[model samples]
Target chain A: MHDQPSLAELLQAVKHFIDETASPNLSGHPAFHARVASNVLATALRDLEVRTANESAEAASLKTLLAVSDGRSLDDMNRELCKRIQSGDLTATSHGLIAHLKATTIAQVKTDQPRYSGLKTAES
Target chain B: MQDFEAAAHRLFSKVFGAEADLSDINRLSGGASQETWALSGGHFEAILRRAPGGVRPTRPSAAIGLATEAALIRIAGKESLPVAKILHVLTPKDELGEGFVMSRVHGETIARPILRDETFAAARLKLPGECGAALAGIHKIATNTLPDLPSSNGSDQIAQYEDIYRGFDIPHPVFELALTWLKANQPAPIDPVLVHGDFRLGNLIVDEQGLAAILDWELAHLGDPREDLAWICVNSWRFGVTENRVGGFGQLEPMLQAYADAGGAVFSTQEIDWWEMLGTLKWGVMCMIMYEAFRSGADPSVERAAIGRRVSETEIDLINLLEAANA
Candidate 1:
């Protein structure tokens, strides 16, 4: 069973939510943010006894990497992580996958544009 | 009504089999969590709601596995204000993920329709009064009617808004301002009425016969009846047709008159005006969730990312509205 997705998929989720939700004023280069995200998750994984390096060989068994990544705002951390990935800072390799996995799965992907709620209501 | 021609017909046809027909499936696009499609089929032409963005497993858990739409439809049906009759709720093991089937009711819900469409022009005049009474009916219903709602919700406006705010981790200055306004303009402590959280001209569906039904009660709560009254008149719902102050689709005079006639006492203009400020403030706060969602990448969709822009758009207007209301 697929527990999580590829790094590409994870990167896409981060890009999507950041583009859709993050404030226009989210300062700094996304690369730095992504590194911060990866490091945060990496540190958490180490503490949780998840995995060591991103060799892909040992990555698959490290399910607990993102497990310890709690209390932190999921979106904020993920956005910072993805920005770094896109900037080519952190690679979405094994061991580092939790940072990539969580970079997606943000909340409230909606719009107020008429297209979303169309000017029309339901039939009475 | 646009044809979601991609996978819709295929999905519905497969699920409904003999009972399905492909017709106009317009998008209702009001939800960040769900997407409601307005469609027509064989004997049934109605809405088809599905989870937004990603696909997940099928299980019955709040905001998790299943669509929980059947639950929404069931609750809406019990409220019985005029939602489309639920014909069937489904978690199609295949296409369109999870959703439900229902009978389409006929009516125009666009806020301006009540003012522009000859069909609803007359009916719009009567809604305010009927809206008041109907809101009362919803509030008076025993809490047991909805076992699913967290029991901690207080039976009042501030409590409900507080719950919604706390549920979403974001701050809204306008909400704080509105909260202040409502506190200052408290209306003599009348009995709480059911506040149709999303009630307005656009949220209302008008039938050919007129004054059809209320729609989208996802944000419904018990609160000051005037909140509903103020909500119906919020300028946002005016839909640019400000001439008809009642949602910009009908005049306030007649609507207020009808409410008064129906035993709804006259809420002071200034007091109700404060509620109007609250309306804008609450909406602005709610809009912040969209921004937070996009930033977090929880549900990544182009549409949601675009929605983040509206927070600023609404905040500016809400600020002005609050200033004017206070003045």
Candidate 2:
């Protein structure tokens, strides 16, 4: 809150350094790892940008799907959703289940790998 | 490093004779479980696959050991399948640790180039048939002659991956849904055959003629042949060219036709869809496992940490597959 550069800005600067400066100077495995590091930073930046909204949306959908109250944390609700799915209480054809899974997973892929081909496939 | 090179040289000299001078010994990268070294000697080129420092680390239960890998390659070669010929299996006397030397088969193993590069256009056309034929030959190998290998049917694999997922102690509703679907739709057990558990693009060497060699026998096991077929069609292996379902180069129809023509069991697309879904779930769980390894400091690398994020890709893939199935 007291800094010139925000967290996202700092992450972007480091990612640019890796992609534009550090990576080109490396070769072979080191080069590959530099690219991966850049990707990791990029993913972090994306997650930071979207995490709050995505989490709240995911939690809201999970509450609807699980018919739970608002007091539970997202982690707690997700664990309940997982238990229901695993225990056969919820299923592929369960009401609002596929929609919830699709929405949640797509949001996650948007942050984790926005360019992943599966994202297009999932959305379409 | 010098000691490793000297030992390797001596081993090569002993195997290929003193006249076969060894040079250009370089450790090829990737693969955390095993080390692959590319070496040239006189007119011959070979690869050394070994465990580091003569000590074999405990690998996952799925992996067949290096010696067994060599044995499978030898058997596959005898079956006239394209494989790197096992030049020598190391012994304690060799003092270079557990490994085998194989005559290298040259080709591109990277997926993107094989999928998009014009250099592989002709290879791409012929690959599905060739891959089918290669798998046919592998599946036909008499199991009695094979070294003792673990075997699993569809349910076994589901249980295995589910156990692994449980071990990670992370909750992903998508994974839970996938597990539920996989269990409900488990295919009936079939007569086990030699299944190349990792038969995707990166494990194959494709030149202009297509599929010069099939490498990485560490995951070789006795299981359903459909496991091999479906594995190649997994979205993860397709790179980005998702239209070409069979390793991002060919359609499923030609591959299945070639499989039958080559004396492998005939399979319909519907029959293998279950396996494809299972393969997707397995990869998603594997990504989680990689992340856990990184978190536990077992193998702290950016690559391992990055793979954890890829689980979402698989999750989305599962949703798509499930939606398609439901449709």
Candidate 3:
């Protein structure tokens, strides 16, 4: 929908999200790093939503934004989320919850997500 | 006595009172997240947990904070778990970084001792299933009750997996493979539960009383309970006790059955199997990150680097399991 925001600008946007949306009384340390995480997720969710809606500018851009990662996916996010959770910017549950909401929305539109049957998780 | 003496004094004075006399301060080894000092305040016993860098360090993302763990300690105590009791959360005024002072408990928490302790080996045998049941207890912690806690549902965990891979800049072929399999073999979504994300042996504290405490809630979050089921059962956590299967304590079926008995809904072998594979991928990437962290000096611990090396073997284990399951 728009040019990808610069990392700094995105960071500011992340701060805005926490100030506006996240829980309060989070243990505060690792401010910049947490900012980056908030920034990345904020941008990722926005981009993912647009892409799922078929509004992403292009495919390559989507990949770049999502940063199809290697090894530990949460190493980066968790580091940030841990700080965020401690900071009260987000909660232990909120990160997963928000990601779930966004990812599910994408799945709903793309219908590309896996659908397992008779699995234990399914029974629940 | 180390630098922590004065620092502990400052923190204790800040939290308890000026009367607190901290003595016998010794730096305990093996905590990546915080500076853990086993110290006593003369009349009272306590452990001083402080921020590692002695500053409010920011993560790669600038908007986050580092001192939140101290609070989580208090939160865990409120849940009636056997975690250390939080006495005070203090800002490191002159020397110590922001940290919480907690009442320390006694137990052997190291993996090697737990595995090798003759006196405790029998107790160790009972741990895997116990660990699973403990996880179920942790999951029972309701999100709505924890003020300022983030909200999560079942699938939020996948994003957690994805975030680690994204951090690496190189999507691990192994992780990608596992992700592909996990996606392909996705289990039906279930009601979310609080997951002790690192429900492994080393993360647990045990005594003759059995399953006395669980540590390292730094990774705890809301997610699929089966993910916790799969985490403890992962091969790496077993430390070659894969023969034991239930996190180096017993077999998967018994562990799952024990978990089922503990009030968890019975999950199919296939679903637990998927989470197991995903657990391998998760741990593999986690170990690599540790290796990289050691190399980068962001955190330097020889054990962590060793753990990194140990994790690769799990990759081979993963392939075998996946093939066997598919077979």
Candidate achieving the largest TM-score: 2
lDDT tens per residue, model 3, A77-115 = 334433443344542133242333233223322222222
Candidate 2 wrongly placed segments (more than 4 Å): B52-54
Local accuracy of candidate 2 as per-residue lDDT tens digits, B1-327: 887888888988877887888888877766656788898877967899998666786644588889999999999998889999999999988888999999889889899899999999999999999989988899999899999999888888898998988877788888888888887777777899999899988889999988899999999988999999999988988998888899989999999999999999889898779999999999998888778878889778899899999999999999999998889
Instruction: Point out the higher-scoring one by DockQ: 2 or 3.
Output: 2
- DockQ of candidate 1, scored on C-alphas against the true complex (2 decimals): 0.03
Ranking by DockQ: 2, 1, 3
DockQ of each: 0.03, 0.81, 0.02
lDDT of 2 at A96: 97
lDDT of 3 at B274: 80
* lDDT per model vs. reference: 0.52, 0.88, 0.58
Error of 3 at A66 (Å): 28
* Backbone collisions counted per model: 21, 0, 49
Per-residue accuracy of model 2 over A8-123 as CA lDDT, tens digit each: 88999999999889988988678888988998998999898899999899888888888888799988988888888888998899899999989988889999999998898877
Per-residue C-alpha lDDT of model 1 across residues A1-124, encoded as one tens digit per residue: 5747754456656655555456343543343344334433333333233222222322232224434343454345434443444444433243544322322111011112222221222100
Better of 2 and 3 by TM-score: 2
Docking outcome class, model 1 = incorrect
